[model samples]
Target: MFRKEYTRIESSTQHSSVNEFVVINIPEEDVEPKQIILDPDDQPMWESAKIVAPTPNSAIIQLDVDDNFVINSTHLKMILENKFDGYLRADPHDHIREFLAICDMFKYGEMHSEVVKLLIFPFFLCDKAKTWFNELNEESIISWEQMRRAFINRFFPPSLFNRLLLEIRNFSQNICESLTEDWLRLKNMLQKCHGHSLAKGVIIQIF
Candidate 1:
């Protein structure tokens, strides 16, 4: 009976060791959690994750929902720590352009859904724009590209784009402007009109 009890106790110990709970020690300060992205060349790409357990020299992270992993703490970086509010406030009417630039910065960061959630919140969007974003189906915006297209369609209406094109066509240099200054001004207008790839000959003719 003693031997049997010892065997059972040993088995329980082994079982507990297999599924041990690890405690994450995040700092008391309002530090944003560090985001982790797997190596691009790695097979079976891992989802972006945030450090939940800040153990010394290492971190415990949860990938998506159930996959918990251990990684060196140094591997993570804080990209969104200071940029979110500045970018949101930079262009009240042109959210799409700012959103695209943000997406580019965090492309491989693996925080697409988290970033999108922040963007759609009332605090980030303007009063008039909030209603339109609120009505969107959350599940449909799984990727950054999908989110980008939605913003573009809503903000950049067909009439607005047409007006911009007309402005480009009717644009002319100001009186007393130097040749170089005029050329630069025309190029700037072309870019704003979304003619980034307009031919040099067309630009010359406009000049």
Candidate 2:
């Protein structure tokens, strides 16, 4: 019942080669449905991807990698069917749930009290990070704070990080209101940190 309205099965055509590239759309407000091109290098991982939809009746999956049926589309409906089948096969609902659950976990970090134990630490995977870690005796320990800082300063726009913060906030104010007790606590924490910038200079590697 979670995210009943935010998930849908997808439909679309796909490349026929084992190593073909495939891209799919993501439907959500304030977020452009970007197509993710998956190459053969990621085919194995793609097999495990979960699908999600923006509405209860919508299917975000075009094909189910696990399905035994093989298809080569010759008509518009067939192509659409394959596309939809792929998305259905991906089972994005699971991913949506995972996304929402993570939001809940980070949102109510205070309630958990053992926040440090639950944090996804960051260890730099770059040259500058190598030198920085060398100065820190290569301990390789880091924190979410470090990840946020590196991402904001060295990587993509702060918006990327901010989007995560916003997701948590949206969950707290609009989504959390409908959630149960455990979810409610998580939402509270999300609301508190939704707009705050992360701290800096700590490295804790996440496995």
Winner by lDDT: 1
Give the runs in model 1 whose Cα sits over 4 Å from its true position: 1-124, 195-197
- Backbone clashes (count) for model 1: 1
Candidate 2 local lDDT, residue 93: 28
Q: TM-scores of all models? A: 0.45, 0.17
The Cα error of candidate 1 at residue 155, in Å, is: 1.3
* Model 1 alpha-carbon miss at residue 156, Å: 1.5
Report how far off residue 114 is in candidate 2 (Å): 26
Write one digit per residue (lDDT tens) for candidate 1, span 77-98: 2223212232322332344455
Q: Give one digit per residue, the lDDT tens place, for model 2 in 1-207.
A: 112122222333453332354554555666665444445454456566698554322111122233442222222222223221112123222322332344344332353322221121112122443333234423233343443344334332455447656554454324445436646655444443434543332101100
